[model samples]
Target: MKKFIIAIDGYASTGKSSLAKQLSLHLNYVYVNSGSMYRAITFFALKNGLTPLNKENIDRLINLLPEIRLDYRTNNVTGISEIHLNNKNIEGEIKTLEVSEYVSLVAEISEIRKFVVKIQKSFKNKNGLVMDGRDIGSVVFPNADLKLFLKASEQVRAKRRYDELINEGYTVEYKDILENIINRDSKDTKRKDSPLIIAKDAVVIDNSELSINDQLDIIIRLINSEL
Candidate 1:
């Protein structure tokens, strides 16, 4: 069997992570959530009072980047992977509305993007892997065997995000999530460093009306053809 590097890129809350996880599991490949890496950094900055609103503070956060260690550990019971920051499991903390509010700001920094890209690239050398993020296909792994760019309407994406957050016990407003999604879309696409652009050879998937099984079936059929 030929292993593949699967890169899934899209705007925030487009179900990129969910799709990548399922694809990886179905193929017994490694699933990597690239956005969680940035969120973890954003979470660390906020906890340490290094808000991206202050240019100097953002620089300080970059300076302290050497001390930041990001990794993943799979849970034995559920066989699901969790993001780890400096050996602490923070999968739960990084998904909050607070992290979403500032993650784009943190990710807009060139140094931060570069740092995360380096880690993202390292996963490719290990085994068959599926990575999902804003820039995974366009920047992190341009030569990936399979590249998928997922997209959805802002309203739909926001609603999906709102429901997920609420289910996770976060008190969030739909309007706020919509605004954040819009802001992130602008920042992610307009940022100078590794802006979220679809690769020339990537397949675009508008999954706004598609169910999880429908989406996965589409991707699996594509993968089978490739194999």
Candidate 2:
């Protein structure tokens, strides 16, 4: 069987990562959460006091990018790849609301995007791959075999994020999550470089009212049609 790439692009909290993870497992493909790469960088900047990104800090972050090492290691228990920074597993650290707040700002940097994109492209060497992020379909893998742009209403997305954080033991307000989602949507779409736009031939999946199984079925049918 010929292996192919699936690129999933969407706004924050739109379940891009979740759907990509599921698809990867179902197809026995490599799964890459591109947003986690940005979050790792943001976490690094925050840890090193380089955030609130002004011109000076941005330049510093760019210079410091050389020292930042990122890689994915699959967990034996879950069989899912988790990102590591500088040989340390910072997966749990990068999922906090604080990281979410700064990740979009970090992703907006041109140098950072270029650095991450170079790494993202290398994943194509895998036998098969499923990658998800704001610009995966539009920028990273424009020729992907199947490109999905996921969307959901702000309220639904915020609620989903809120529930996730709460279940993770973080006390968060739904209003704050909603605001972050809105802000991220604006920043992601208006970013000067690699703004989130649906590829001309990509399929748009409005999963606001759909379940995960429903999405999986739809994508499976599409893949079968392509085959």
Q: When superposed on Cα atoms, how far off is each prediction in RMSD?
A: 0.9, 0.8
Question: Alpha carbon lDDT of residue 176, candidate 2?
Answer: 95
Where does candidate 2 have its weakest 10-residue lDDT segment? 134-143
Write the residue-wise lDDT of candidate 1 on 84-199 in tens digits.
Answer: 99999999899988899899999998899889999998897867898999888888888899999999999999999999999999899999999999999999999999888989
What global local distance difference test value does model 2 have?
0.93
lDDT of 2 by residue, 82-148 (tens): 9999999998889898998988899999999999999999998899999999888788998898999
Candidates' C-alpha lDDT: 0.91, 0.93
Q: Which residue pairs of candidate 2 clash?
A: none
TM-score to true structure, per model: 0.98, 0.98
For TM-score, the strongest prediction is: 2
Off by over 4 Å in 1: none
For model 2, the superposed segments whose C-alpha errors exceed 4 Å read none
